[model samples]
Target chain A: MSKGNATKLLGAATLGLMVAALFMVFVYAPAEATQGDVQRIFYFHVPLAWVAFAAFAITAVAGLFYLWLGYPVFDQLAYAAAEAGVVFCTLVLVTGSLWARPIWGTWWTWDSRLTSTFILWLLYVGYLALRAALADGEQGARMGAVFGLVAAADVPVVVVSVRLWRTIHPAVLVTREGSHGLADARMVATLLVSMVAVTAVFGWLLALRVATLRAEARLRGLAAELLALERASEEN
Target chain B: MRAMAAVLLKDVVVELRGPMTTTALATVSLLVLVVLVFAFGPVWGQSEPTAAAGALWVALVVSGTLGGGRVVAVERERRCIDALVLSPLDRGGLFVAKSAAAFVFILVAEGFSLIVALLFFNLAADAALARTAAVLALGAVGFAGLVTLVGAVGGRAKGRDFLVPLLAVPLYVPALIAGVKASADALGGARLGEIALWLKVLLSCDAIFVAAGLLLFEQVVAGSE
Candidate 1:
């Protein structure tokens, strides 16, 4: 299938899954006794966090490929993924904060999880800002790729920070005790479904964004070629 | 190696002769002091000597970031970066020399700031002061090296003034955490071994950044050209 066809299929699948997941969240999944309806936001919030991290990881890998192979396609893909990652990361922060306000009684806290997410958000925002501000295309990609790879070192650091700092936020998925909290079959199944659904959505968004960036690059290249031709003709 | 030495010496000589950069460094140090006073004043009163020691290191890192950014951004602005790239010296060696120059400059600034902090805050000399100074040196070296590479990359960017910090600060976190822990231990008069964990973290980060910078420097410079 063509890229467009694949994208369309993926988009359709994403919308379908998202609707199904939302229904499951509100109507099917049982509410926690400790937290009420607000807890349902976790279905979307956690998925957003997962997809954001996945997008950044992809950006880093693409950056490495661009540096190694000097491929413009890889650079463009990395840029697109970083942009998408920032959007998802912002969603995670906002939704997480919203959930926290009702449950934790505070909109913001410097708990390790939230702090690391905030830092991650800032890193990508800076990444996008750097890309937007740079004028030279090739040069910008080179710089951006380097920054992407370097900045990615934070992912693992962020993952390990809570362990290092002994902070309040629980490591919901990583730690053994936290895993026990989700031992319920229904909860685990629902979370897994949500993860898959969000991953599919991220893949779909990335495909569309990459296609758009490639089209823009091609237009710019053609414009540069035309400008060169005009200059040559005038010289003649 | 001698070529690298020459590059390093040239930067040091230029800096020594003009001293504008040093004065700027001092000014940044003062600004850090003011900022720290504001940040920590509520918790530990501005008159507390120990707080000043901790705050001094924070100031050093901030000033180091600004100074490191200027080192390469200045070269790019003057159209001299291309000349540097075209020179026969090894690209990795160039990275090392520039990073060394930045490291030394920051160390000097940190030393001056420490003295200022001691005087302003009435800190008494203790074993902790020595240990804290050593940790600051290690952290400063690593921080300067990383920021130098970041600044070089940012120099080729369109909004370098904005890009350098965005690229550098997040990377500075591990170092900042380690530096603060080490400083706190020292200020509390702990043994060198007491802060060994933080020291190891700083050392590992330093080694990683230096290696990455060396490996990536040529690609970054070539891409800039």
Candidate 2:
């Protein structure tokens, strides 16, 4: 009923779902005929990609809300999404890299998906870093909101450019496309389950982060008030 | 129109008068080319058009980051950004004007870099230079457009020199990839139509970046006070 109770319930539910998803990923998802167990990473990897994009989309939507309403709550929402988005984006790159090493035989490549994901990672990593560097006030929030918008806008452009770039340069290997992953019903089921589970994880992280930021803001406000009271008492 | 021109004109006049930023940009660009010399060492010669294209664009990107980061820095330093922000001109106009000026300045620096490349790389001299120029110009516009926004955002944020480039350069990735390939095609004397796709991609990048800066610049410059 209470807000705290609701968060705890959500947290416990997501944690359970994620544990089940992990089981599905490692056990339920049958290994590919070609790539073997290495192909199993796809279950988690695809969901990470999905959730990261979703998180970034949240940042953009929340930022627009902040801009239109001049509300700090929306800004806080954007900040939470941006921070979580960066973490997921980093995992996407790392998972993609790990997947690539076993399959593509390289640590990294300029493939369309990987390239766009990398660019997305860089933009938001910078966003979080920039927010940290700014004065923790309305100015920081406003600037961060703008950065969120810019990063969101670039996602499509990066995808298109990377696709074009990939076409110009031959695709060395096609993995994780419709041909392989979708054909197997178990793999498909595993992927679907993981996507739901990972999304729940995203929601959990976002809510927790937003709450933490709010508490920090409150602490800062209380500190300022305490200082003011001290100054007033000294004068009296 | 008058206000936009004034912003552009002031940037040009200041750069022409002092040439400090240009000098710094030129020096860094030249240094990058020198590093390319190591890349294209004994086996690779100046006649390598592909290598030349790669080197030229990397040099351009490096210099552009350093130069472009200063777009808002100069304004912030003189506290002229406050003046610009307070001006009656719409934020979109200011963004367009600032981008135009930065684009032209980058082009100038790239032109000088081209000349230096000609001497160092012994690049192809014929019809390809024209296409290379086109690719460079389009790429510069796109690069400047996005970087100016980054500069504004980063400059206004707390003191982090690397922040703008880190944030902006990734966005610049699409343009850079398109430009490098297009430039390489041009240097190879590939037909205009052969490179048409790259040109189109570059144009779209330029358009999107300009539109983005125009639309979002107000948000970036608007004070939260």
Most DockQ-accurate candidate: 2
Give the interface-residue alpha carbon RMSD of model 1: 2.0
Query: What is the iRMSD in Å for candidate 2?
Result: 1.3
Which segments of model 1 are wrong by more than 4 Å? A158-162, A167-180, B45-50
DockQ of each: 0.59, 0.73
The lDDT values for all models are 0.79, 0.84
**Candidate 2, residue B186: lDDT:** 91
What total of clashing residue pairs does each candidate reach? 0, 0
How do the candidates score on chain B by TM-score? 0.93, 0.95
Cα deviation at B87, candidate 2, in Å, is 2.3
Model 1 chain A: worst 10 consecutive residues (lDDT sum): A171-180
Instruction: Encode model 2's per-residue lDDT on B143-211: one tens digit a residue.
Output: 898889888888866665788778878887878888889998899888879988888878888887888
Error of 1 at A226 (Å): 1.2
